[model samples]
Target chain A: MSHEIPIDDGYLDMDLLRFTTAGSVDDGKSTLIGRLLYDSKNTFEDQIEAVEATSKKRGDEHVNLALLTDGLRAEREQGITIDVAYRYFATPKRKFIIADTPGHIQYTRNMVTGASTANLAIILIDARTGVIEQTCRHAFIADLLRIRHVIVAVNKMDLVEHSEERFNEIVAQFKEFASRLNNIVDMTPIPISALHGDNVVDKSTNMDWYEGPTLLYHLENVYIGSDQNHVDARFPVQWVIRPHSDEHHDFRGYAGRVAGGVFKPGDDVIVQPSGFTTKIKAIEGFKGQESEAFAPLSCTITLEDEIDISRGDMISKPNNPPKKDQLIEAMICWFSEDSQLSPRSKYILRHTTNEVKAVVQEVRYKVNINTLHKIEDDKTFTLNEIGRVSIRTSAPLLFDSYRRNRTTGSFVLIDAQTNETVAAGMIV
Target chain B: MEEERHSYQVNHLAQLESEAIFILRETAAQFERPALLFSGGKDSIVMAHLARKAFHPAKLPFPLLHVDTGHNFPETMEYRDRYVAELKADLKVGLVQDSIDQGRVQEEKGPLASRNALQTVTLLDSIEEHQYDACLGGGRRDEEKARAKERFFSHRDDFGQWDPKKQRPELWNIFNGRKHHGENFRVFPLSNWTEMDVWQYIKAEEIPLPNLYFSHDREIVHRNGAMLATSDVVVPQPGEKVETRTVRFRTIGDMTCTGAVDSDASDLDSIIQEVATARQTERGTRSDDKRSETAMEDRKKEGYF
Candidate 1:
């Protein structure tokens, strides 16, 4: 057997796309991921052989591709995905990271964790069942996490006779439900059969009436350039680079990933909390002085003035500085199974390289994820529960709403005593 | 076409590099005493390169700890010494032989016996002796089934045991490095990188590797359907014939368990092409993982990197 190099010299120019899969249980989520890996030639011979042996041992007809995932022993024995399993595959055009998360309702935290860093989300809908409660919950979490691109894959189309009518009906149903979400910028629906490999990697010949790009095509060509916050200039200083060497003496640079907007030499910036204003003298990148630095680029910057700035300090434009306040209202997903979130619960909140002690002032309401309704009376938050809460920090936090900037708007709460990450919060 | 590629739109290599640099800087800022777990392998070499770029002009804030198995290829050891000197960073070596001498671990005795599993004890002892709250590993999720469920910031207990079922939910780019005393975390900067990505990045960055990775003629013996080099640690077993063959290692591990594949691709481009067309996973030739179906999982649960 011969295989072509799916990539070439221009492979270095290929961009990366991180996405996550979400939907109801038994929707063939894992199989869709396996099919993607296999059809793309990313699956190796040993992995295939292993899966085949497992399938044969389990007495299954046709190789069970889902076994390729489900990495844990218990997960494989139970034939289910328990936690998030990250898988990587690359075509000549782009490199893709797939966060295959479990779809059980009790695994809401898994979906939230997987969706946190995803640039896009693939929500699988069973062609026969159409949209269900789990589907809405997945869409809700995706929207809440502010994922810009969403692909509504109407999977298992082979079971529905590859009917164009069924695909359209499911797309319509998803759009109607997704209309309530405000953060999703682009949503494309495609009919696919994850098992039979229809319109996933290659276009489906059975569904001739459906005329859309295959799932792989859309993934490779999606417009993700505008997904970042390029309008707001925010830099959260993560580390201070002082070489302490004679050759680079008198050099002090604030190093951090550009959280938002474009930063350039001579740009006027303000240091939060201290309210010190300074001008950027130079942007020191590894290659040398970069003309401009934008969101997600890790670079070091030197200021014109010798202002004392340390980790967790936010640098933004004076014209549009981030909101500075001690009281924060946000929606949080409870992730701790050992404890529950109650009023007056103290935790260490970390946001944008800064850490602060915070107290849960009040739990306003619990969100019924399936129905997207507020349960006002049930304010307690347990494991896998999400709710709106008000928190008061010991020190003021600089930020924007999660809708505006994902980096500056997100934070994680660590249990003070347990040191475990208990909640993931998005500033509202 | 050139104008279409915006500055904000970074390529996959640059993106992975940036992510790694960010993680490195975070590790520096979070941990009081952190160390990079260097194995003189390609992954750790790439990781050290990233660390250099992360804090340019400034020496690496942490030390590079190599848990020597005492059965390594000579080229790897030489490369480790030279690379450490070039970076001007601190180097710490934990020897499995020392662990054996100290009666902490017993050496296996057989044709298939290897010090591969014994390195875990030495590694844990080094972490404890050095009080490293965080150890940056070159572990990538695509390398093994157990690694697929790994988080960027993987937590460990006081006994250095990993509880996969009880991992903290890592969200976005914000990592929680807060831990109690005696407990440490294993941070993987290349958790999302695949073997192809690693090679592509190495080629793009022009990073150098040990000579063992290139094709060369070596005496080898066949065992368990893999080509094992006839080194001092791994000699010919009874009824096994030793032959000279042109081969190269897909991965760098202990000389006892690592297997070389027949290949003529000696350079970066050809090696990448070979990797692209190769029918086996990079770890497929590793005898350590071939021991059982869930060998990696079991070892990882026992605090293996």
Candidate 2:
């Protein structure tokens, strides 16, 4: 219950950018993770020893850097990742948390989960197998997740002898196909050898004609500012703090992380649902008192007046409030094992701090991930299938586009009977 | 959009803190009787901090629950009491010793034996006795591969077992805290935080922590490739050498099982430096984790926090 922040020093350089690796069996996602961890000094002696021991036991030819992240026993035995393997490494410039997800078709859910939180999606394309269906599938999901930046890591330059022609061919095909999608912020194709440690965390010497930020540089300096919703001021109350049993009993503050925009203490704000107006009393964090808080920072705030604020409530500017409505048009990814999409299926819709009874009124279409096409005639939605659906909630959902605010614009559907999460939906 | 002396001078750090605070509030509102698990560790301490920030003027909605193994360090217990008392949050202690005495659990014999694995029994009994539907803990995915498989709002069956194969998919930040009768949910707001991320956030946020986290001089003994603290609960084995060593615990758990490394990280920066260069994982020092390949998974399945 102690509200005091830990007396640790130094701030995270916002230069830290999150990226995911996409590739199957031989495409080098694991190698890339291993290489990054190894090259970045993130690999400790014990970890190296563990990997070396595993490699020796397996009787592999060389020290498999990929074993650094193959973490699961099954994955180590099978030589493939089935679940997301999150790895962390930092440079002087920034910190990184790479959601190393499986590239196999069976683990599309894992990829979707990893991509959902990424600012940039790195699609690893084997130079030998250029423009494959899985390549298309990975790209499609990355785009769907609203990932602003895309980096096609054309891996295994060593296999192609670091050929420029092959890289160009893959690049042209990808660019031609991706040009059809209008939402791409920036797409840069880089050729590297994840196995030989080319252009991962450091610049590659094998490719002199190419000049680009080594994989680490791009990740360290990728433009993520535009990814955050700087224009929408949204604060979803996570907790309410009150030090009662004294004169402070009257104190009521809304504590939460700022999802988007800047929250200034004196700014006039409107409480969602109740639509009550108030001014921010204070925004308190470890850096001491501050005037404004932006997305992703956690802070405690005291309102100028006592309000009936609890979780799931939104506090925003009156003039630029999020759309509040019960009829939601969204892209829902089914997650339940037993439940299938059906009209009027009762479920609990969880968005931010709010929970409400909701029904899937319609399943417009399901997208074929491999082909990146919408199956309009499909009657039912299955697990890991991205689809468009219309939902009607018991209470209006205060929201923004999933493109704008990942926090306020996203909702999860839970099966009422078994209490299983049935779907993850992003508001359209 | 910059304003003068706005509410507590909002910044990115404040935003993250606020989000955690909001999630804490939701946990309070969405669950019938929730208890924040206080381990007196860094992560749980941060969890408690956010809980306070969530409801500043009002008392924390729920109480603090600790399933004490009696093998825990005296410092941790003192810090736990001081912290809870300072915030006036009700503290609930469920002792593993009591569970063993009541025959709910059995004690393992031998010098190398630990009561670490037995805490789960006391924890489950406490949950049933107190009727806690939602138990919030500071679990992060980057800590371990199995933990990475967990969802934000992890649903547990009546037996308190986690089916990794049957885990509910978590999308975006929307969490499903709903459960049927007798079922429970374990909520981890820090599921996304990594060890380095947690440390960085802790330092950046200036959160207060116990002195044990920083390097301090303590009576210790060398045993089984780890430094064991010289405590009343854990006696040195026949061949183990007892010595006073300057060490800091990366994690604090049952003293009988928790291990420490030789360190001079008397400050946060030094600790971060040590963590960055740590040869073994924080869990690697945990003797209970060294018991088996799926130790945490098995303990978690039995409703251990």
Candidate 3:
């Protein structure tokens, strides 16, 4: 079938929304994503052909949509997702990036990795099973990651004969558990049968009692405009662009993606940790000059006066500079199985564009993800465990609370010996 | 037209571009010696474009490394030369033939034999010879299943092996490029982009590509349901007949494995439209992936880009 490429304007105007899906093996998380892609016309015919062939070879009665997300050979053979697999799809309204993460108990670190940068999280719960411990664990992680939007998709409505009571019960149970957590501002609950194409793309006629929007409808319309920290005004210098050419001689610009807030031409800014103040002369984008630069927009900022600015430096409004501190407290998600986190252990801490040597000053407590309990007695953190810890860096880090600004407030700890990312940290 | 406001909203393409540029700059800053793996493919071209934009007035910090299999489309090589000369960037070629001649790798035998897999050895050898701390690839996760699991800052062992199960967790935008003396990192800036996204970006940015990407009459032969470009490297098997067909390459790999698709998409707009409705993936045409279900994964585990 021939398709027409619309004018570039349509492609240029679309916004991006990144969401994560967390569910146990049988919860149909893959099927939900597959349905979203299939119904949205994102899945190609050849992909369907491949999945169909695989499903038939595996002796499945129906075409298993889960095969779409289970892209790895082992995962496909085992019929389960083991790691975080990113899937892309687009509607006319917006583009989407789905971090389809495994929901097994041992894969908590995988869920965190997927949900960390997600603007929204979709927690799948089987209608027949109601809210299980896995459901609570998923919601807890979503909350811990401070995901602004959460959608509790009560799947398998077809198996439950489209029972509205089952959907309500699961929603109520999830809401009760979610209330105990923090920072999930918008929580939506919808009943869907991913396998039977009900309440996913189009409204399910089987569930007349349900009045909420379809999963696709909610996904397309969700307001993520205010998700970024537009008031903080933080820019972490990633690179210093200097072209030693005759035409553009003496051209020195600080290149970076705006971490937070808005930066306009002529704004008085401070360069940290040097604390040098300067004024922004112009903001250069890839195409040309931009009127203003906001969070996540990569641009080159030319200052009015030449100052010593380099990579790992932060540029912000002089009046509202990021917190410059050597000692910081943050919630840590230990990711490495090779090493455990303990007091006095030194690791390379990367925050924003800056990297510094950091030592664990204190292990405040270990968190029980399922129950959201803080075990104060436990002073050690192993793989897949979340804990609160205080770290002292060799140099000061410019930051804000992760709750205030996810970009600047997050950091990763890398083991020096192996260079493996051992843990993820969110500023408290 | 009214002046576009850059404050209230940022489009998806702009966002993706910004993220990619950020990653490119990060790689340049973190690594002492980094090289952009240029294959003269659409993805690589887009990557080169992004790299140029990342530094703008400044020249790219790293050179461009092309691991040549000695079996290439003439158009691709010419394009590569012109593109590098235009940017005034350093170009390094790691020849598979050189590796074969040096006894570092052996050439495969038979008609379906390709230097596609041998390039991995040449690539690793080149990395060692140049001491490149980081290799920027145009690999996108949406292209292949194994690639979907790759991190933006993927770590490789001293032996240049990728352990899929033991990958470091990549969270937020903080990438850990820290490694020991011998170990290097594989940085994929286009990890988030899809085939459609790449085409759309190319169209929007008006990025120049090899003419092979557009439709033209070429000598091709049908084999295993793919249109293989007729070349000295590809010896046709029994019962396979050559014919002239108007086609374009969806992907640009070694001429031995990369196939062409029958299309009339001679321009950027039409190509975008063709990609939008294409039934198969861009890699589907490549005979290399058709070798086995886990071919890409196996090759990736052994340090294939």
* CA lDDT scores, all candidates in order: 0.90, 0.78, 0.88
Clashing pairs in 3: none
Could you give the candidate ranking by TM-score, starting with the highest?
1, 3, 2
Q: TM-score of candidate 2 restricted to chain B?
A: 0.92
Point out where model 1 deviates above 4 Å: A1-8, B1-7
The residue-by-residue lDDT of candidate 2 on A1-428, one tens digit each, is 11234333444433446677777667988888889888888777766887798889989898999888865556667887777666766777666768788876555677777877777888999998998888887888788788889999999999898998999999999988787665578998999898889998878899987887888778877766667676788988876666665785566667776787778879899998889999998886533566666666666777897778877799999989999999999987776556687766888888887889998888888888777678988758776778888999999889998877888888888777777777778888
lDDT (0-100) at residue B208 of candidate 3? 88
Instruction: Give candidate 1's TM-score.
Output: 0.97
Estimate the lDDT of model 2: 0.78
Per-residue lDDT tens digits for candidate 1, residues B236-294, read 98899789999999999999889999999899989989988888999999999988998
Candidate 1 structure quality by residue, lDDT tens digits, A278-349: 899998866567777777778889999999899999999999999999999999999988899988899999
Ranked by DockQ from best down, the candidates are 1, 3, 2
Query: How far in Å is the alpha carbon of B260 misplaced in model 2?
Result: 2.7
Candidates' RMSD to native: 3.3, 3.3, 3.2
What's the residue-level lDDT of B105 in candidate 2? 82
